[model samples]
Target: MEVSSQHLLSNEYTEVYRRLPLKLQLAYGVGHVLNDVCASMWFTYLLVFFHLVLQFNNWQAGFMLLVGQVADAVSTPFVGFHSDQSDNFWLCRYGRRKTWHLIGTVCVLVTFPFIFSPCIGCSGSHQWAQIFYYCVFISIFQFGWASVQISHLSLIPELTPNEHDRTKLTAIRYCFTVVSNLLVYVITWGILHISSGEESKIGPGDAPKFQHVVWTGLSLGILCSVIFHVFVKEEGALGSSDVRGTSLRTPIADILRSVEVYQVAVVYMSTRLFVNLSQVFIPLYLHETLDMAASALALIPLIMFIGSFVTSMTIEKLNRCFGRRLSYILGVLMGLAACIWIKWGSGDQFKSSQIHIIAVLIGAGGSITLVTSLGITADLIGDKTSSGAFVYGIMSFTDKLANGIAVVIIQDLHKDPSNTGYYRDVLTYVCGGSALLGALAVISFLKKVRGDPLGYENVPNYNSINSDVLPVATEDIQPSLIS
Candidate 1:
C-alpha cells in the first residue's frame, strides 16, 4: 500500500509540472504584482490630479484621458500581432515578449514623471498647451503600458496547458494584485494624512504628499521592470497552432477567430468597464458628496482590496463549485448591489463603518471577476499564447476600448462637480446601470457559449490537443459596445 501511494504521488507531481511549474507560477505572479502597482497608482489619482491640481474641467480631463486610451486601443492589436509573430529579434538576447517588456519600461520611465508634471501646465499655460501636453504624455504612458501589458499577459497560456493550472495562476496573480493595490491605498492614506498642518484634507497644492507616490512609483517601477526581465521565461514556441475561429486574413485574423475569444471579450469588456467607472468615481463621490477626508477616502480602496486579497484564495474553489460563468455572475451581482447602494443607500454623510462594508462587497466581487476574466482568457487561448501574441493583445484591446468609452461617457455626462449631488447621482446611475448591463452580458455569454470546456472537469489533457484548430470568424460588425 505504501509503495502504491508513493507511486501515485509521483505521478501526480509529474502531471502537475506538465501543467505548470511552481516557480514559473510565482514568477508570473511577481510580474503581475508589479504591473498592478505601477498602473494603479496613477490611474487611481488621475481624476484627482486634474480636478484638484491642473484644474481642468471634468469633461476636459476626461476627453484628455480618452485620447490616450483611444491611442492605446489602436496600438494594442498591432503590438500583440508583432509579438506573436516574433522570435529572438535583432540583437536582443531576450525572447519576443522580453523586447516589448524592455521598451515599455523605458517609455514609462521617461514619460511617467512628465505626466505628473506636464510642461505646459507647470509652465503657467492652462489652455490648449496643457491639453496638448497632457494628451501627448498620457498617450505615451498608455502605449508603453499596453506594450508591457500585452506581452506580459501572453506568457500565461505559454506557461501551461492545463485549465486548472491557469486558474491557479490567475488566483495567485490576482492575490498579488490585491495586496499591491492595498499597499498603494495605505501609502496614499499615509501621505495625505501626514498633513502640512494647514488643512486635514488633500488638495492640488499638497505637493509634499503627492510627490511621495511619484518617487515611489518610479523607484518600484524600475525594480519591478528588472524583476520581470529576470524571472519571466517565454516558451519560445507554441505547442500547437490549430485553434478555433473562421478568419484566414492573417495569423491575427486566426487569433481573433476563436469562439471563446469573442465570449471572453464580451464578458471582459462589460465588467472591466464597470470596474473602471467605479474606480474613477469613488474618490469623487466620497470627497464631493460625503465630504470625507482624503485619508478616509483612501482607506476605502485599502478596505476593498483587503477584502479581495483575503478571499481571492477561494476564487478557484468558487469556480469549481459554481462554474466560471455562474461564479462570475455572482461577482457581478455583488458589484451591482454595492453600486446600487452607492447610488441610493450611501447618504451624504461621513460614515466610515458602513462605507467599509460597501468596500468589502465591491472588493470581493471585483476580485472574483478579475481572477476569472484573466483565467478564462488564458483558458480560451490554451497553449497558443507563445504563438498567439495578438490573443492577449486583443484582450487588451477590448479592455482599453471599453474603459475609454466608459471614461468618455462619464466625462460627457458629468459637466462638473460643483453640482455635487447631481453629478453624484449621474455617476451612480450610469455606473450602476453599467454593472447591470455587465451582468446581462455575462448571462448572454453563458447562454451562447453554453458547452465551452472552460471548467476543470471538462479540461482536455495535453495529449488531447490534436491537429484540429478553429478557423477565424469573419468580422460581421464592429465589436459590441455593451459598456
Candidate 2:
C-alpha cells in the first residue's frame, strides 16, 4: 500500500512520527543552514563586491550572477539524473546523496574564496578578462551549491514519509536559515565601516571585508557537511531495490500539460524573482544609497526574518480561515505596500525604522506565499505515478531562470555607477510590479485549486516553513514503480 502524500495530512499518517527525533531534525536542518548561509553570503554581498571591488559595472556584475544562475539551472537536472544513475565508489560507500554532498562541499570550499577574493589574472586592462574570470568562478560556485543543495533537498522525502515529521524538519531548517542569514548580515554588511566618501575611492570593494564572507562560507560548509554526513542518514538512495522515479517520459511535456502544476511553477518563479531582487538590492539601498554603516546594515535581515518567524504562525491560520488564495493575496499586497515605501520614502539618510517595517511586511508576505505554495506543489505530486524528481527539477529550474532574468533586468535598468545613487524609481516600480503580478498568480492559483480531485484545498494547515516547493497528489502523481 503506497500511501499518497495527501494521506500524510490525515490523522492516520500524521502521527506516525509526531515529530522527528531531535538529533535527526537538528543535523538535517543545520545542513540547510550551511547551504543557505553560504548562498546568502554570495547573494547579499557578491553584487556589491563586483560593483565595488572588481570594478565591474552594474550590468557586468549582474551578468556574472545571471550567468551563475544559468549554470546552476543547467547543472541541476544532470545532478538529479546522475545522482540516480551513478555507480561510483562514493555512491557505493556513502549512499547516493552523501557522495555528492561531500564532493559538492569540497567544491564549494574551493570555489567560494575566488568569488569575493579572486587571484585570477589581476589584469587591470582587459575588461573581458575580468568578466570571464568572475563568470567562471561565479558559475562554478553556484553549481557546487546546486550539487549539495539539490541532494540536501531530496533527503527530506527520503528521511521520513511521515508528513508531520517531515514538516517539522522543514521548519527546523527554515529557522536555521534565518539564523544563517543573520550571521552573514553580521559578517558582511554588519561590519562595513566606510565613511560617506570612501565608497568612490575604493570602488571594487574592501578585500579584507569580503574575505570575511569567503572564510565564513568555507567554515560553515565544513562544519555543516561534517554534522550532516556524520549524523543524518538516507534510505533507498543507493543500492536500494525500492528506489523510485526512473521515468523516461518527456518531463517538460508532462509538466506543461498540467495547468495547475504550471501555475504553481509561476507562483514559485514570481516569489523567487521578487525575493532575489530584494536580496540583491537591499544592501545597495542601505550601504550605498542611504550611506548606512556596516552595523546598521546587519540588522535588516535579522529584523526581516524575525518578522517572518513572528508572522509564520498566523499565515497558516489565515490560510485555514480565508484560504491560501486570500492569504497569499494579502501577503503580496503587503509586499507591494513595502515597495511603495521604498520607492517614495528613500532619502539621503537611512530611515532604518521605515525600511525595517518594509522588511517585516515583505518577510511576512514571503512566509505566507512560501508555505501555501509548497502545500500546493506537494498536493500535485502525492500521486503514485508522477516523477517527483522531474517535477522538482522543473520547480528548481523555474526558480533560477526567473531569478536570473529579474536580476539582469534590475542591474541593466539601473546601470548607475558606484557612489552615484540607486535609481529608486526603477527599483521600486520593478519590485512593486513583480509583487502585483504575484498577487495575480495567487488569484489564478486559487481558481485552479477550487476543485482539487485529491482534496488538496483542505490540507494546507502548516504551522511552520517548508523549503521544498516540490510534493505529490494522487491525480497529479504517477510514481515510477517499474524500475
- Model 1: lDDT equals 0.66
Clash count for candidate 1 is: 13
User: Cα lDDT of model 2 overall?
Assistant: 0.63
**How high is each candidate's TM-score?**
0.84, 0.80
Error of 2 at 391 (Å): 2.1
Model 1, 451: alpha-carbon shift in Å? 3.1
Estimate the Cα RMSD of every predicted model relative to the unseen true structure: 7.0, 6.2
- Candidate 2 minimal-lDDT segment of 10 residues: 474-483
lDDT of each: 0.66, 0.63
Model 2 steric clash total: 23
**lDDT (Cα, tens digit) per residue for candidate 2, span 1-483:** 234555555432122212356788788878866678777776777787787777678888888888988888887766755655436464535667777667777777777787777546575647878788777777777778777877776565556543334344555666667667767765654446443232333344467777876677567757877898889876432112222434333355555577776777787777766666776677777766666655555567667777767766565446556755676678788878878877778554437467788888777776666655654454454431224445555667888877888788778877445633564554477667777777788676656455633223444333353523333332222122112
